[model samples]
Target: DIDVLASSEDAEKVMDHFSTLPTVVDVTGKGHTKTSVRLKGGIAVDLRVVSPEQYPYALHHFTGSKEHNTKMRHIAKSMGLKMNEYGLFSDEGNENIPCSSEEDLFKALGMTYIPPELREDMGEIEAALENKLPKLVESKDMLGIFHFHSHYSDGSNSIAELAEEVKRQGYRYMGMADHSRSAYYARGLKEEDILRQIEEIDELNSKYKDFHIFKGIESDILTDGSLDYSNDFLKNLDFVIASVHSQFRMDKESMTKRISTAMDNPHTTMLGHITGRLLLSRDGYEVDLDKILGKAAQKGTVLEINANPHRLDLDWRWVKKAKEMGIRIMINPDAHSLSEIAYTSFGIAMARKGWCEKKDVLNCLDIDAIKKFLHN
Candidate 1:
């Protein structure tokens, strides 16, 4: 629920502003303190106005998963306090506690501040109490990105152009993991094409002393649990990211087997979009992710958090488990265009949601560190 706070004098003005929005198809309800609207895309939005003094409490109470709020209320009850949207109160209902910010509210409850992304009742409260909540990964920590495409495949830019853009964005390094030969629909690179691209990358590396480009490919994982390229071919590249772009209809057992086989490949540096899920569109193919995570850990394969907004795979729910299994993660934009490269921020948010710290993300490392990790 989206909660808005404003002074009593501006409540109606705020509601009026929303009512006049071009995208609002209909104003379903309006009241002294609440207004609801349906957008052009059939998405419902709610706006609630509260006093400035009660703003922080209302924000905390509403910007929560029902489960988290319930847990918080229970904690308050045990502490001889009563919590509500307005504010925390004494059990006798005679005193109102001051909560000027979310931090104050958390402090009042005797816990460290919890980010909204981690407020899904997923052990965050307990972690906060113990003061063990992860220092979550942020966009500033991304020193480089991986799994991007170029005109060598279906991308809009050339290797030189994309590399320059990456350098412009303040990243120290970039990996060009264009689609491999088997992805004919995407104009995947052939053996000869791969050799030429490698040479071109070498030329660019010589030109730009500050930025480095690793020769990589997003090789397709075949139906029988084999990679699209031979080991001899894959060994020539700096790294490999194996992904499933077809044969997504396999049963759970088969899909799990397919991914496990890819992870076991000696040249496979990472696994891309583990579940093939597209948010709000397609459900990721069904597979036993536990098995995949175990195999990834066993093989020391880095799992990817596809940074594309539409495909933030390796869903955050499995992030903590992956870390526990000793698996590291890389956040990749999977960029096919220059603008899409900025999608790394979205991936970082998802990483934080998974309780990931800087140490858990592979791309947060320097180029030298990444080279060592990939080589190992």
Candidate 2:
């Protein structure tokens, strides 16, 4: 469990209470002013101190539901507070207090009480007008994107073209997860083809300065829970994104075994599109998502929010479960063409619906961090 603190007194009170719980493991105070608290049972809490004057803005920033925060922002715009993740902004451009308190911030925002979970835009906007609005996520605080596809396998453009597009959109980086060898329907690359693609990516990196390419493969997790390539080949990749392709029909146990096999692979950095469910076009293949998501979190693997309009697999509901378990996520447009590269925006929007933030997203990493994560 996580807790947010507002002051030294608050921290002391928490520490005193935590001392009584036999299961508590550790307590760490982080953030500016050491306002955070960690519980012993692997539960962490952060405490913030917001001045009474800045309470509204602080509460708005911390109490987040992307949709709710969005609605609250509309209220702030009317009231003249330019709210964000860090703090509320005044039109005069003064030094920000970065208020750390939640309740005080809410009071400042002039809103009635609303919990974080209830912040979705359902009716929060109307509520805020009467001094109530659910807190939401802000677009500016978002770092970047994680998974995407290009012409390397079934993608439409070369690695260089994809990088250029992501850069144009102001993203820090994009993961080049082209299809694996078994996806013959999408022109999946064989071992030699994979090596050749790696070389081309190297050449592109030499030519491009602003963006970097990650040597990743969207490898197929075969029906029997085996990857399409040898271990030697999988290790050569910067990251391996394992996914299920053909044989959508199977029992729950079989599907679980298939995914378990892939997770067992040390090279598998992510489990692609968990549910295999397509939003409107195709009903997703059935699987034990709770089990799969739990395993993924334990193994340090991400679940892809396949951003393809047709295949928004790993529905937003599961995303919530992943968030609770601290499971990492990667949202990709599964771009097959240059035009489709912009689909990251669509994916990001969907992630917001699941209450995902940059910290929860793997694609938010820069090239170096990504390299370390994959290699280590």
Which candidate comes out best when scored by TM-score? 1
TM-scores for every candidate against the unseen true structure? 0.96, 0.65
List model 1 lDDT by residue over 231-325, tens digit each.
Answer: 98888899999999998899999999988988878998999999999999999998999888988888888999998999999898887789878
Error of 1 at 335 (Å): 0.7
Among the numbered candidates, top lDDT falls to 1
Q: What is the C-alpha local distance difference test score of candidate 1?
A: 0.90
Clash counts for all predictions = 0, 31
Cα deviation of 45 in candidate 2 (Å)?
A: 45
Residue 324 C-alpha lDDT in model 2: 70
lDDT of 2 by residue, 6-43 (tens): 43324444446544456545545434333444455455
- lDDT assessment of candidate 2: 0.70
Displacement of the residue 41 alpha carbon in candidate 1, Å: 4.1
